[model samples]
Target chain A: MKRHQNLLMALAVVVLVALPLWMVHKPAPGPDGKEAEIFAGADSQAEGLIGRIDPGYRPWVKPLMEPPSGEIETLLFALQAALGAGFIGYWYGSASTRARLQREQETTTSC
Target chain B: MHIMEGFLPAKHCIAWGIASAPFVAYGLRTVTKRVREYPEQRMLIGVAAAFTFVLSALKMPSVTGSCSHPTGTGLGAILFGPAAMAPIGAVVLLFQAILLAHGGLTTLGANIFSMAIVGPFAAAAIYRLVRAARLPFGVAVFLAATLGDLLTYVTTSVQLALAFPDPVGGFWASFTKFATVFAVTQVPLAISEGFLTVIVCNALARLNPRELQEMRVATGSEQEVQA
Candidate 1:
């Protein structure tokens, strides 16, 4: 039963990922053949809408640091996440190990 | 939804910030109380925040030939409840805005309101309701995570609609347009997130029943054995 569930989940993931990729990459009927970017991050899409709504509107704020390139931006984001995950994983592992050891020592002393 | 830098009018941004302030305060209080009661939970909260950060950073292809990321609040909401997740989510959003340039400081309040407060609360509510219904753990997790993700997008759509109502059809029409666009990407992402959370939850339950128990996830039989 467990194996069946896992297989189903794996299949679901493949389909979910593949369907989108295929849709995105498929040739479009437009003259340009380039598909329009229908899905934008909420921020950009919202900004675009705001621009359309009121052309004279100026942005009140700016990003603190913009990465030199998109790749660099992605790299920095990934780095931060990795560092955070590493710290968290280490902390959890050590705490759990210490707790187990303390429990074992208590049982031995009691015996 | 991350309202871009200068996307929302100044008033909208300030309003969202004010709206989220109380929730953030409450969440900090919850975290402090938990940490005081159990020093180990300090690390757990940090781990939860990191987990949210890492998972949300994963970009996936969407139906519209664009990339979207998961919100990743479901697992944390399941572990720590919604109130506790608010502060953790705030940290993640702040990092994304500053480091990734994904969101802006001015829009941070709106982003936090949608992704942090609303998303986690929705996830927690759904998880609790489904679990109370005595459904399978996997099903509950899947529903909570998927719906939580969808709800984030929905909230974002509403925010956008409110800010820029369509000239022709007004707020409702504008909202529909935004929601439709978001749905194309978000629906698949939500399903993927649901499966991922369930897999992660199951793995945690098997490998670290103690952690699951500490987080108060009902590991059922496995937890019983460990106890």
Candidate 2:
């Protein structure tokens, strides 16, 4: 059963990964003969739409800090994610150890 | 989805903020009550929030020329009911806005409505529905996470449509365009998130059955965890 489950998971991962690549690479240009962008996020789309609607509109607020470059911004985000994941992993490990120790103590007392 | 700063007009921003206030308030009350009742839950909630932050921060390639990330709301909603995710999600969004420049203060409410409220509630509902139907544990987790991710984008489309109706075709046309554009990337993202969430849940169940049990009790889902 475990093996079957693992196989299913592997299939899902491959399909999920491949679907995006195919969508990105295989599509012919539209009527305008312009290739579709492969990665525009929702926020940018919304911003672009708003700009088209009202060219005069300005963002009322600005970010306090901007990264030196796009790559730096991505690097910072990755760093934060790694730190957060590490913290959660550590907490879960320690919490499990504590629970095991408590269970052992209770068993000994019962004896 | 993190709606960019100033993408929303002031009134729309305020309106969304107003709409989200009650949910955040109620979430805060539930979280405090849970923490007071079970001190251990404090750490659990923190860890869950951290997990959300990390998962959301990991960007994946998408079809729209912009990267997309998983909301991570489904796992939290499954562990701690939908309502409780509001405040946790708010914190994560706020941090992203300030620290990462990913989201913005003005658009925080709109972003929260999509990622926090709508996504989490949908996930929690689907999870309960699937589990109640006697589905397998993996199926329930996959559906909840996938649907949660998809619905977040759907809600974002609605928000964008409301704010920017099409000049000729009106709101419906605008919504269709936004949804279609986003679906290019979102569909695959949803599937990937589902598989990733299932793996994470399985790992948690194996390494910390006690924690999983606590989550079941806290979420009021007393069903036995399948091996």
Candidate 3:
């Protein structure tokens, strides 16, 4: 069970790191007052040993060169939505905490 | 409110992971002691199994159509006490993951911590407080139900914020979005849950006060320990 959790965590790390890096170089400066994000082409080649075997290789996974909405604010919030999810996790741990607190209260009350 | 995939920042997930470790440990310890102290371990396990089946199987659609199931902790908390419910909820979540695939096994701790540990406490607290205020049983039940659902979302939002914190938007905005997702759908669902919980509580109250007392002893306030 623990190993499965580790594997999931590892997969999450790999995807999170590689995907964003594979897609965008940086947020571009917009003509207006905003900053724009530029897209990376799937055709761009990797230089490492793995790529040496197949120099002309393309990535199996490809995301749109463009951001989902092209809005940094929305994209940022979407990220937040994922990260903030543990609030529910904390709630899941609460019932036992309740019983513990109540037990403490009972002791104090009796005293 | 399973927190959705790719919703939160990595940091939030890690922090929640840290926060959950102790709860899991403590819940296991307490549950072990309870089973050892009591003679009806099998019966208790059966009750938990049956109760949990209802909790996950009785799903109704929420805003996202992601299929929200009842935490069902209100009655469980009132019946058992919050401590005992942690393992039950965790087990139920485990079962749901295997049987229903409603939530992820990777996120099992997070799910158990929220739905089981948190839901019952919020419900039980509200129940105790409302009853102490001399409110009607129905009102007490409704308030507990509402708070349980609200707290569940709040916990979920916090988890999201921790998993995916952004320096620009900060935690508040993140909290707002997550909370809103729940608020839109859960507000109505909770109202109905409150009505149902009230009905159930009232029915059980009438049907068998002794069972309620036993459950309360199993799950509830610290006073039971001293008694």
Candidate 4:
């Protein structure tokens, strides 16, 4: 189970990193939708099934309401993602800092 | 705060995913180190995992009657401390979004930024201030927990506003509704967080005072100087 979890997490990381790169670097649409066009059908169909089956699917709609466009929207999305990752990094860093400080206090006080 | 799909543009979610990656990396390191250090690391993992699972399940209705659950930052902060809580939170949020589909994959960054990042810092800062001011831990914990909850909503409101067709009014209207509606349920939860923080901290402070002391030292937070 742990191995599977670790693998899944690794996959999430790859997709996250690769997607942004692909979006930015991928040739500006030669035809219908980007590579996402292929997967989007499966994705939406899944959403459709869930919404149809689950009475409590209303909350999931808000984040998927609109597709982004142009440079500005893309920039905003990137900024938001960067901020999210940074915030998480900062959080754990701060926690460790606190723990270290606690350990130091114990040392100084006892001495 | 749940970041629903369609709340932001799809591009935004993609960006959020990118932004959240480094944090996950840092979190992975933290998880490894901590797991290695503690003798009962496996147990610790189990406990954190279980509580997070249960907390996510305990959804309540808002004025929108859209259901929301506790951030559980207070709970994480109590057991793991705020720094440690970050990774735990990131992992939990990711799991919730991906596995449960409770939150959107695209909005993972904003959702995590709101819940994991904001929540514990709110508690930690307040607690430290209380120590500096020589107020009881009890008071500090309460204020921290309350503000933590408040901050989560405020952040959520901003994200929702930014995503809509009409950003400003959309944000204000949603903010007003959620901020108001969540308070009733959130109040008790905040208090519970505070109460739990103090209780748990007290237990830690008593048991193996040296290790707890080492924690503070390693973290570089000053001892509570009675003012």
Q: For each candidate, what TM-score against the reference? A: 0.86, 0.84, 0.56, 0.55
List, residue by residue over A57-98, the lDDT tens digit for candidate 3.
433322222234536433443433333233323332453365
Per residue, candidate 1 scores C-alpha lDDT tens digits across B56-132 of 78777777666677888888888888998888888888988888777788888888998898889999999999989
Once superposed on the true structure, which residue ranges of model 1 sit more than 4 Å away at CA? A1-11, A26-42, A84-111
What fraction of the real A-B contacts shows up in model 1? 0.58
Candidate with maximal TM-score: 1
Over A35-83, each residue of candidate 4 has an lDDT whose tens digit, in order, gives: 5222121123323433433435354354332333445443543443454
Ranking by lDDT: 1, 2, 3, 4
Candidate 4 lDDT over B83-156, as tens digits, reads 66667677777655554444666677877777776676676676677667876654665566657766775666
Quality class of the docking in candidate 4, CAPRI style: incorrect
Clashing pairs in 1: none
Over B81-150, each residue of candidate 3 has an lDDT whose tens digit, in order, gives 5666777677666644544333445555666667777877888888888878877666776788767866
Task: Quote the lDDT for B166 in model 4.
Answer: 30
Clashes of each: 0, 9, 47, 42
Task: Give me the TM-scores for chain A across all models, comma-separated.
Answer: 0.66, 0.66, 0.29, 0.40
TM-score of 1: 0.86
lDDT of 3 at A101: 82
Query: Distance from true position, residue B165, model 4, in Å?
Result: 6.2
lDDT of each: 0.79, 0.79, 0.52, 0.52
Candidate 2, residues B1-227, lDDT tens digits: the string is 78887677899999999988899999999999988877866766776687788878876766555667788888878878899999999998988888778788888898889999999999999998998988877789889999998999899889988888888888998888878756556877788888877776665665556666866622223344332
